[model samples]
Target chain A: MSVFVTVGTTKFDNLINTVTKYSAIKAFQDLGYNRLVLQTGAGKIQKELDQLEELDKFTVEHYDFKPSITEDIESASLVISHAGAGSILETLGAKKPLLVVINEDLMGNHQLELAYQLYRDQHLYYCECSTFVETLKSSDFTKLKPFPDKKPKLFVDYLDNLLGFK
Target chain B: MDSELGVIAVLIAVVVCLVPIFSIYFSVNRTCKTKNPNVTSTKRTKPASVMIIAGSGGHTKEILSLVSSLGSHYSPRFYVIANTDKMSQQKIEALEAEKIKISNKMEYSIHTIPRSREVRQSWLTTVLSTAYATLYSFPLVFRLKPEVILCNGPGTCIPLCMAGLVLKIFGRDLKIVYAESICRVETLSLSGKILYYVADSLLVQWPSLHQKYPGSTYIGRLV
Candidate 1:
């Protein structure tokens, strides 16, 4: 059950339909993967999800409410998330390398800012929300870079600020 | 009765004279207290209740690292409290609530002010939104009652830290610290120097800030 936590929002179909046949979902199905859990609400898709219904061979589980997904996140080695900054940080803290698909409408160009910041810092991989399929398929999980050898020093200053270290 | 009234007047005079002397003495005492002491007094020091404030950005990411490093001693809290719409707040909150591990020591809360993304004809919109944000965030700060407030920027820090400064003045002892990021990519950004004047401690990830704010400490890179 190689579960991919797909946020089952309506926009997912747009990204999925772009896959044609070579999507990561299709690839996992071909590889005899058992189940893929969609961590999202069901009624959000308005006739748009039928195309995605073609891949029903991969047992689909819908966490109808967002809260039910307290544990579906634990299923994947890689997290696919909207380019929300909070999501990116959570995925990193979970110690899983992420494939970040950004929200287009926050802080003008903030999703890009976060992705580039993490990508530049070697924390995670960033890609456009428009190209979700391409991003996930090409996501090189095993080759993800680790955090720096030593902690960043401003951390020491933070400690000094909080504790006033002598 | 005449003698008693004169005694009363004399007593009032003595109290008035002593009050100024006491005020000057306390003033001098406070001045001396701020100076670096070779040996500390036996005063029972209260631990600083630190609040790390940041928005949904790299600023938040770096603050998380410090929260971990500062570890057990700093009993801390978090505040997002930003300028965004309700929908944006839901998304950020959902992501944050998902990320925050419920802990005995770590308490998390967020405040969002409703604002339109549209810029034109929205000058009034921004001012009202900013006012709303400031108005709601006071109780959060009051309840937490942090002794030291550390801010990571982008409009998120302003309201809470302003409250923190007020706490400093009225509460008679609180410090405001600003975490300066290594990169200065955004000009007129909330990060570059927003709280420079008020910050008791200004920590920078990059050494360049050392030259920029010679008074500021360059603490190297943050996470």
Candidate 2:
């Protein structure tokens, strides 16, 4: 199994640090995971990523950005991402098992609203930066419900109506 | 002679009453045609151009979803993004690439403007950057002459929307549509609040938002 961690085009050092640590890597390894791919935005977690390569417990690839992380998301067994709506929508759209980590240090509390909503809806699992490890240890991703196919046509109709399109 | 004068007065009264009715019809028709740029008689004509303010992260995603849902109704779309935002550029490039692969037409372009502020940047610096970004948008807005400008809740959208408004003030027929971000279940975001006044139409994803923002129209989630 493989895990993909993405911070979504912005720096979230805390989430990167938590996942790149030896303990987190080892925990995944013990659970039969062998590969990890991280798209680490602008954060300075490259030094730690390089050191992890030496351990040889699993293969890890890190990049500042990938034009299309969808390919990475598809190949991974699990996806760990920042609690951004785009990332969540992509993950859920793909019907992949997802674990979202919200950075509490950001300016507004908006991300919390989305994270909690999805969690309550059973669409995905969410953990704050502080409780990431504990939640990771306890959660069973198989039990999560698949995201429903949200009909996008309604939005189109609304726009057409608003625009007075025939 | 008396009967002739009475008949003439009745004709004048009828014309006066019909004048208001005709004016009302013309006004409604004019607003509908101009306010809705996509109301062309046929779809075979070139699709209307839309200028979208694609902010980083979530904002970019929501806009992408909106474009996809629009399908071929609007075309030659332009995305305005922050100058330093390589991630958004990459995401858009990826989306465009996939779209081209699916269909051979290329109808979108991306423009980068200076960011108003970086994360954790000082307020003094933010003001300077914002002014620069707003000034930079003036030429781009004139160049594109987009029929419609679409934005969600993001600080980056403010200057671009203002530029569109400036164009409107100059007697251009353009519409600015602001969709409050889906994440705002209870209240509007900072950008949403500012845009509420300038945006020609404000749409909220959650119905509850209509009570707070009386003019806001409730639409289901775009994503």
Candidate 3:
């Protein structure tokens, strides 16, 4: 199975480095995932990624970005992502097991709040760069609760009622 | 006697100007005081016009997703975006195209306004730009006179909502609905904070925000 790692449209060099570590690769292999698909965005870690790929311990595919990562997200058995709301929602919407890595270097800690809240709700697993490897090795993906389906009707009905349409 | 007449003239001029200013202020304030979301108006069988404020990136995504769920009854949609925003127009078109494939009757327009504040901009420049944007949005809001104005956590929404308030002061029924972004679990964003008092309906995705601000309604994840 393949594990997709996306950093959205921002650079997360620390996340990239942590996931490419030898121990992390071994953890993935132990979990029966032999391929790694990484969307690196603006992170400058190509040299390390290349060396990791050459080792051939696992298949490593890396790209800066794509117009849409929906296809990759759909096919992945697991997803490791930066704590961007768009990425988090898309992964949960796809019903994949998501482990969000909070980028502490970013100016605001709002992403941390989102990640922690979702984690509290048992929807996903989240950790900092320091604990990413250990969390990966120990977290059970099967325990995540499925996010509720998008209910656009709620707002529509609310608006309609407010506007006296009903 | 001439000096007294000069003073009287100045006083009259001040009163005349302040009368309209205070009138406008009190009208807008009255709209804010009436926070009842369920207050129904005249029943209308026709579709209502809507003006949507689309911010860059995540804000644009969330607002459009909310718009896509809307049925055709909310028609002639007008989208306002920052002129520097390159992605929102494309996303809006894609969404409209998908809608057209399903129903074929789509009426929408896109307008661009100046960014209220670019990243790292000085507070002084932000104030100037915000004023300029509010002036720029006034005519657009006046002409469209959309029944509903919908926005999420975008800086651009402030000016548009201000323009909507202008419309309300002119004796038009305009509703401004502000939805806090889902990412905001504990606190509201800057735009959300400002629009809380001005918007007709304030929606929060998480329960914490609703608990913190009793005025905002907890809608439970509309996006």
Model 3: TM-score for chain B = 0.81
Candidate 2 residues B1-223, lDDT tens each? 3323322332343234335533564465333233433444534344568898888777777877777667665778898898877777877887777777766899899998877556545554555666666667666876798878998846677767776775676556677998887787777876777778889888887666778899888756667
* lDDT of each residue in A1-166, candidate 1, tens digit only: 5554543333444333332334656766654566755544343543444445645556655444563333565666556665554455456656766776554444354235546666776777766556665666666676777644446444655555445543
- Give the top-scoring candidate (lDDT): 3
Those runs of model 2 whose alpha carbons end farther than 4 Å from true positions after fitting are: A11-17, A20-35, A49-64, B1-47, B56-58, B75-145, B163-173, B183-186, B206-214
Predicted candidate 2 versus true structure: per-residue lDDT over A38-138, tens digit per residue: 89998888887777656576788888887678998899889999987768878888999999997878546665677677788798898877788778888
User: Could you estimate the TM-score for every candidate?
Assistant: 0.57, 0.70, 0.88
Ranking by TM-score: 3, 2, 1
Please, what are the lDDT tens digits per residue for candidate 3 over residues B79-190? 9999999899999999999988878886899999988766555555556666667667766776788889999956678767877876676567678999899988998876
TM (chain A) per model: 0.64, 0.90, 0.94
lDDT of 2 at A108: 61
Model 1 per-residue lDDT tens digits across residues B1-223: 3323332332343344335534554565343233322122333243455776655445555565565555444544454545543443454455445445544333445545432112232333434444455555555665577766877665556656665665554433566777764334222233335466667777765454467677676655555
Q: How well docked is model 1, in DockQ terms?
A: 0.13
Q: Which ten residues in a row have the lowest lDDT in candidate 3 chain A?
A: A49-58
Per-residue accuracy of model 3 over A1-166 as CA lDDT, tens digit each: 9999999999998999988888888889989998999999997887777776465657889999899999999999999999999999999999999999988786466767788899999999988888988999889989889999988889988998878888
Predicted structure 3, TM vs. truth: 0.88
| Candidate 3 chain B: 10-residue stretch with minimal lDDT | B2-11
